[model samples]
Target: MKEHKTTPTQEKVLEGMDKVYENLIEFKKKANSDLVVMENGKIIRIKPSTL
Candidate 1:
């Protein structure tokens, strides 16, 4: 097996994703409805029940 190294940019992006996941977990605990977000001018909805 070989070792792998994460680049600085990849590290930053992973950190950001971790934060977003944490926030979503917290939001799910306190939210009773679905969450909506706009991506590329399109509205995407995520159901809290699925989370």
Candidate 2:
């Protein structure tokens, strides 16, 4: 099987996502409520339980 590696941009994005995930976890613990985020110009609410 061929091995694949992440490019610099992909690595950067992954790192950012990791930070976001951590922040979300903390936010959920403190806020005890759903998270609100804007995606594709639409406002979406994500339940902490769903995460």
Candidate 3:
């Protein structure tokens, strides 16, 4: 197994991305909206409740 190293700035960016993702999920749930994403080269819509 190999270990990956990230710079401090990279770590902060990754953390920010995670927070944004969490907020997006929360927004979707509250808005009763579907999350659109790509899977196996296909576009799909998933209900937030499914999460």
Candidate 4:
């Protein structure tokens, strides 16, 4: 495999990932729940018990 370096865009993407993780923590705190449901990076369902 070839070694690759992150470009500016790749670095930005990494930053976005960090933000997403942080936001997920916030979501869990404010919702007081861990029943997060997502599809394609967007919330499609929440508090789902019947599936």
lDDT of each: 0.86, 0.89, 0.96, 0.73
| Candidate 3, 1-51: lDDT as tens digits | 999999999999999999999999999999999999999999999998897
lDDT of each residue in 1-51, candidate 4, tens digit only: 999999999999999999998887677667666555678989765542322
- Model 2: residues >4 Å from true position, as ranges? 34-51
The regions of model 3 sitting more than 4 angstroms off are: 1-3
TM-score top scorer: 3
Candidate 1 local lDDT, residue 3: 96
Clashes of each: 0, 0, 0, 0
| Residue range with the least summed lDDT across 10 consecutive positions in model 4 | 42-51
Clash pairs of candidate 1?
none
Candidate 1 lDDT over residue span 1-51, tens digit each: 999999999999999999998898778758767778899999998777767
The reply for model 4, stretches above 4 Å from the true place, is 35-51
Pull out the clashing pairs in model 3.
Answer: none
Cα error, residue 50 of model 4, in Å, equals: 25
How does residue 17 of candidate 2 score in lDDT?
99
Better of 3 and 4 by lDDT: 3
